[model samples]
Target: MDCDLICNFKKCRKRLNANAWVSIRKDIFCDDDGSREFNKSTTCPACQTSLSGTYDIIRVDLQQSEKYKTMVLAGQKPETVIDIASRALAFWTYQITQERTYQEFVTNKGKERNIQMEQYYEQILARTAAELTALKTQLAATKKELESVKKKYTEATEQILDKGRQYQKLQMLYDALRRKCITPLTFDMGDAPVHMPNRNPSNFDLTLSTRDSILRRENNVSVSTTVPRSPAEREFLLTPGPTPLPPTISDECPAAQSRFHLHIETPNRAMSRPH
Candidate 1:
């Protein structure tokens, strides 16, 4: 099936198993292209050799052995010519064998690269699975911690509500006692009425809203607008912290509760006032 004897012409690559035209320069051509080229010029188409009357372009049968084959094998020439022909045949055979081997090597190299690519993909897949498992475990732990914080917040809310109810009941009792002090009820056993002790012993009210309403307010100090021109105004009361700023001037200042509020440039200490 393979065309071992093909036309040597560049444009005519057809098989020439039956008969072919051969030039003296060893150029082979098919019947149709060769006849056209020969008629067009007496010179050889391939090498430009003069082909006048002699059979420079001869027709040969490839299927049958030619008469020239006997002349070449009968050692019609010197031994050096035979050796040169043998060397040329050996070089052509070696080149053909190497070409077949190189094609198989390339094919095997492509298959090896495909296998390596598959192995790299599998490694990436396994790493992704491991990372996903760790993330899922971290998410579960976060959910558990969130539930614990929710339970603690709920318990604290209930405690605050109970304390607020207790404070409201104590405030109602204090208000009733203070009102009783204002209006006296006496026993008429004695001629002179006896005075009861004042119910509000602290003097100032517990709530700041009651005292704030009694005092007249003044404009607040705007730190951004106030520019210090004098040395005394510019002088800052530098205190080592973490202490707080000074308490504002009020009617209830220097009271038992004022010790907790007025703390600028003062060291940390408990109230020295009597309980």
Candidate 2:
């Protein structure tokens, strides 16, 4: 009952009452973990101090100690032994109680450290998870913006190509007219609503005149026509009636069953605006 030694490691709950290790610092530990720690560093684990080799720690046998103590006190007088016994018994009793108090202090310190460590790790984890979620949202938004820009780029490219083709066609038409290779397609100035010649005009026979002041003064014709070399031109030559849409004319140009639009160079109107 006098001995109540235990391992100094706060986490270890092993008893060292029978046989144990005692360091110069008076720190006590159990046989198993104590020996292992000593061999690993040859240092005191509790104080974090260097040890002066194996002399710093000593193996103690409590049963042998008590037997030896009794033997040494045996040879003395009964009264002398009795008086020394009282003081020695009290010393050992208080020493054992002090060791228990120190164990409780170490255990409490270990618990507080564990709690603080858990709190710190939880805060770090929550912060990291939030950052990960924000990054994912940003990536999704970036992808959407990229797709929108790509769609607008494709539409602009198509519009540019359409305009280029229209310009080339106008250039070729102008060269042919200036050379006098094309004959004028006649129109009725009388009550007839400007008859488009019934026959499909050949390349040399197709002609266009403008409604603008300059062309009006030069030629006696008032109405202008855009005669394409394609079959769509003959469709216009048909007498006024219901007409079907042509594949050649697209969303770029608007057309009605009896009328179509053309881009002609003039002082005011370079191209017709879409309705």
Candidate 3:
């Protein structure tokens, strides 16, 4: 087939050049009869292309079917079409494989993030628990200290109250003793006796002589003597046996007599009074 003629035919039919054809004729001679004959062309009449020489044009036409006509009219170039088809199939297969790999990677990353979040939450819980325990310990210690302080205050208050009671008791005793010491006295002063005589005597006579005798006898007698002396004997020895009276004893001499009387009265009075 001529390439130019095929190109012209494709433009007219709006089809590919590869599918165009042409026809040819064959001549034959018989040896005995010496006759010559020409065979008709069995190739395609429009494209002038030959068949495989196994069948007539009528049989080929019957086998060709509508599928071959559609394939020719689609304008496919043989070599270029093969390369484009192979690349398209390979690219689709690669895209399917990459999609599966990307899905697996995203799942793994999600799991790692979940684990990290769980660990962080656990750490926060542990720290919070420790702090609460420490605070409880401190509170217990403070309570014990407060109880000790309250006990001490109670003891001190009791001691002070006891001392105050003792002081009150002492004060009561002091007041009682003071009342007893200063209580008023109640004696009978009207019955007491007077020592001085009611009237002074003028006589310095026998009564005076007798009192002098008795006083002298009492002075001479021992305190331990058991026997009492007769009054006459006591008078006989104590009187100076009527010796002459001193000039001071005379009644006419008033000054001398007064002096003698005073001396005699004082001695007798002191002796006659209680020992």
Higher-TM-score candidate among 1 and 3?
1
* lDDT tens digits, residue span 39-130, model 2: 78768877777778757788877667677877877779989988887865664565577676876888999999989999999899899989
lDDT of residue 28 for candidate 2: 72
lDDT of 3 by residue, 1-275 (tens): 11111111212322222322221221111211111111354444334556445432211121356888677436778776777677645544443444455557778898898899889988988998998899999999999999998999999989999888767655555554344333332122222333445334343233545645654554356333345444433433223465433343566765444433433345456445553
Local distance difference test, each candidate: 0.59, 0.62, 0.46
Ranking by lDDT: 2, 1, 3
Highest TM-score: which candidate?
2
Candidate 1 stretches with Cα past 4 Å from truth are: 1-103, 177-275
lDDT of 1 by residue, 68-98 (tens): 6666457556687778688645644543454
Global lDDT of model 3: 0.46
Q: What is the TM-score of each candidate against the true structure?
A: 0.33, 0.40, 0.32
